[model samples]
Target: MRIMAKTDVFIKARIIKGYSQRELAKKSGLSHAYISLLERSVKSVGPATAKKLSDLLGKELEDLFRIELL
Candidate 1:
């Protein structure tokens, strides 16, 4: 499977929302390492994770992660 996270959008949104990766992890109940992987597009963001980020960053799921199962 391949995941193409819109990392630029995600990072910008996170910054605009006043959250560093660690802060976002804590707020969203995700691991910092996992957040890092997501941001780096090294791992696919699961649905639950996508929901959490979308809720926290006020970004739509489509804008953040474009995960396509191969």
Candidate 2:
């Protein structure tokens, strides 16, 4: 049996909150281009950015960002 890997729910939460990328970025004090990178999983979110997004989107940190162990 195969299991699906857990995915970040950032886009879903952003949609549910009815905010466009630009809007969310402005609200979260980030740039829309950066937000695009985040949504696409092209960039990893740091603790500070995660906290900003979590508080702004009213989502749990784990729900929006994944912590990768090095």
Candidate 3:
């Protein structure tokens, strides 16, 4: 099964909030590299990290990430 990467929504939310990856990292207290990986869909975010990012982005976790199978 292939899992869908919903990082695009995360990216759009960050952009809408006028935050760069570095800025988001600072706000979310996550490393910039990790945020970069998240944006690139190269890494899956954990629940804790997802919560932090969703809070920072002013979005719900459900709106940020969607899981699918293929």
Candidate 4:
């Protein structure tokens, strides 16, 4: 079994919040490239970075990402 990343959840949350990647990047103090990579699932976010994103999105960290067994 493999633990899949739920980058889609993050993307959906961002869209629902009406935030562009660049906007979120500015608010979260993360680079737009990093946000892009995260949404694309090319890079995994660390706990600190996840916290920053969740805080900016007004969501709980758990709601931002989930693990799925595959």
Candidate 5:
């Protein structure tokens, strides 16, 4: 998946779950700056950090990535 798409999904999911970037950062044990960068797609996060976000959002890591329907 493209980094931007992945970031978008992550942010969308967080919003759907009623979390602000600051709240998500707290829950995910990440910095607010890092969370902002991730949500804005300004930085490409490594797998571990991505997994932490996924876990905090109660979503699977695979769901954050864009998947081909075929």
Candidate 6:
């Protein structure tokens, strides 16, 4: 699995939406820590988790997976 760099745009968007990590975790059916790890680029999300998160974030899976700094 590849670890992608964290994107400010993504994090900002989520924050601006007033989404708490626990809320996002509930909405995406992912663990809060797992989501945190992914956002920090400490871990990579698999297909299923990516799809769930993308859907929750209203973003495409490809967009979510993109590491703009790479």
TM-score of each: 0.88, 0.84, 0.81, 0.79, 0.74, 0.74
- Candidate whose lDDT is highest: 1
> Alpha-carbon error at 24 in model 4, in Å?
0.4
What is the RMSD of candidate 3?
2.8
User: Which number leads on TM-score?
Assistant: 1
Which of candidates 2 and 5 is the stronger one according to lDDT? 2
Residue 56 C-alpha lDDT in model 6 = 73
How do the residues 1-70 of candidate 4 rate in per-residue lDDT, one tens digit apiece?
A: 2222367888889999999999999998989998898888777777777777888888888887664444
Q: Would you list the clashing residue pairs of candidate 1?
A: none
Regions of model 4 farther than 4 Å from truth: 1-5, 67-70
| Global lDDT scores for all candidate models | 0.85, 0.75, 0.79, 0.79, 0.74, 0.70
Off by over 4 Å in 6: 1-6, 67-70
RMSD of every prediction: 1.5, 5.7, 2.8, 3.3, 4.2, 3.1
Residue 61, candidate 2: Cα error in Å is 0.3
Per-residue lDDT tens digits for candidate 2, residues 26-66, read 99888999888888777777677788888888887766776
Score residue 61 of candidate 3 by CA lDDT: 82
lDDT of 6 by residue, 31-55 (tens): 8887788788778766677777767
Q: Write the per-residue lDDT of candidate 5 for residues 2-70, one digit (tens) a residue.
A: 333277678789999999989988887889998887777676666677677777788888887544342
State in Å the error of residue 18, model 2: 0.7
lDDT (0-100) at residue 55 of candidate 1?
Answer: 87
- Let me know the TM-score candidate 4 reaches against the reference structure: 0.79
